[model samples]
Target chain A: MNIIMSKTITYLQRVEFGDCDPAGIVWFPNFFRWIDAASRHFFIECGVPPWHETEKTTGVIGTPLVDTHARFVKTASYGDVLHVRVHVAEWRDKSFVQRYRIERVNPDKTGDEMTLIMECEEVRIFAARREDGAGIRALPIPAEIRALCS
Target chain B: MNIIMSKTITYLQRVEFGDCDPAGIVWFPNFFRWIDAASRHFFIECGVPPWHETEKTTGVIGTPLVDTHARFVKTASYGDVLHVRVHVAEWRDKSFVQRYRIERVNPDKTGDEMTLIMECEEVRIFAARREDGAGIRALPIPAEIRALCS
Candidate 1:
């Protein structure tokens, strides 16, 4: 039996003071910023060309998120280092589901125990410039790109 | 027949140069920031005291998001003024749904049309400090607070 497994990549982020809210916890929105970066990094590490380079031939400018669902499991403050594990959970004709698991190392003298901070699943599409040049439209998933990422 | 209506409020935000990403459009995460502010403003405009004030009496510090779903409909850039319409979509025992609709005034000669930029629905809980004071936990929906918001 051939076993097919999705590729996963880990992205690291350090929480900054400015990322916290008045309650001294991560402002929540910053998690989305890191998730976006991790999504890009996952493709880069998987041997996919940068969107700008691919746009020349594929007309794929970038992945634009259409829908997202996120759950905040724990609160994090500044000075915390987070590990974001990203993978493609599902692939459709014109879009894909990118999933992220964000964790923080245990602080209570535990041995490398990782505590989940947040998890997110986003539906995004390869977007191209519209004919009118005013906005963007989704493109079908590129076969070569999908093979590389998968 | 007696009918009860939930209060709705509109919060305005002005996009700044720093809010845009390298793509020259507003970074997606900033939408969450504006949505959060709008969530808070909704309660304030409805006559609910600030979280800090309520913390003393009700032990409710703030509404923390547990889950969220968002859809991006249009792209926005700097100098655009967005209006976020927010209201409580549902009220559960320990959690509630806060909905936001972000829109921008039509830039074309099309008389004051509002273009939908993004929409989000969040499941949030009224949180209070845990007994250990190390974290937060959800509290029952306070009737007075709900009455004020509704």
Candidate 2:
């Protein structure tokens, strides 16, 4: 079992008007979506995209989160391009834990430094797939993913 | 200035798929969208059709969210239909506060018991509109809405 699969922080931005709330602040849910997207992007860089690209790919199938926790540090507004950093904190034969830090890059937008939106940690399982691809299975992480991420 | 021309309490259901995270639990952000939808629904129930019909009739426009806060308690999972109950917590001159509670309803989905899952508290402000309907205007809340929620 491993506590952390890999640790290479990643970044992204917040665009689109729907990201904001009626109060003009970045709606909290968008933060989670950003974090998830960044983690997926990291995997893509590691050669295993979050979603299986090739049918024979020995990659994650469901990747359902078992638990999620986050803390809000500051406020984010519409049109703010923020930085999303992700790292694998813990890993096991069956599952792994990942964390995220969201910060504000353009102070003029939210008019602040940090503006910590969330410090998030999610525990997820590598959902398994059946031979016929009808139901789910819980399989161990593949060696290539582990090696790349590690 | 008023966001919806009225303050009202709104309610919504927690569907099975609405739980989007792998944790089999409700993700933090989905609650905000539910609250926002319920708020828009509240206006329509109060005779202010929000999306398509009313906005075209009255030159008065809706305000966007500037800030929000939410707290999670117990978890809800598959087949659990949640009840999102909203109330006007504070009705100020330029802005008002809305409080929400996500109750885990019985399997029958009656909401008669209203078993509690979590609660959320958020505040929103209203701005006076510009002549071109593009700029900001600061005005007092309408008397009718205040009377209803006050």
Best by DockQ: 1
After superposition of all CA atoms, the RMSD between model 2 and the true structure is 8.6
Question: What total of clashing residue pairs does each candidate reach?
Answer: 0, 19
Candidate 2 global lDDT: 0.62
lDDT of 2 at B45: 64
Regions of candidate 1 where Cα sits further than 4 Å from its true position: A109-112, B1-4, B109-112
B66-90: candidate 2 lDDT, tens digit per residue: 4455555555665677777776777
**Candidate 2 chain A vs. true chain A: TM-score?**
0.80
Q: Stretches of candidate 2 above 4 Å error?
A: A1-10, A17-28, A35-80, A84-150, B1-10, B49-60, B108-112, B127-139
| Tens digit per residue, CA lDDT, model 1, A1-150 | 998799999999999999987666888899999999999999999999998898898998889899999999999888889999999999999999999999997767857689899999999999888888767889999999999999
**What's the residue-level lDDT of A48 in candidate 2?**
69
lDDT of 2 by residue, A31-146 (tens): 76787687777667766665545224764555655556666555666667788888777768887877788877755645555556657777666765556743345577666777
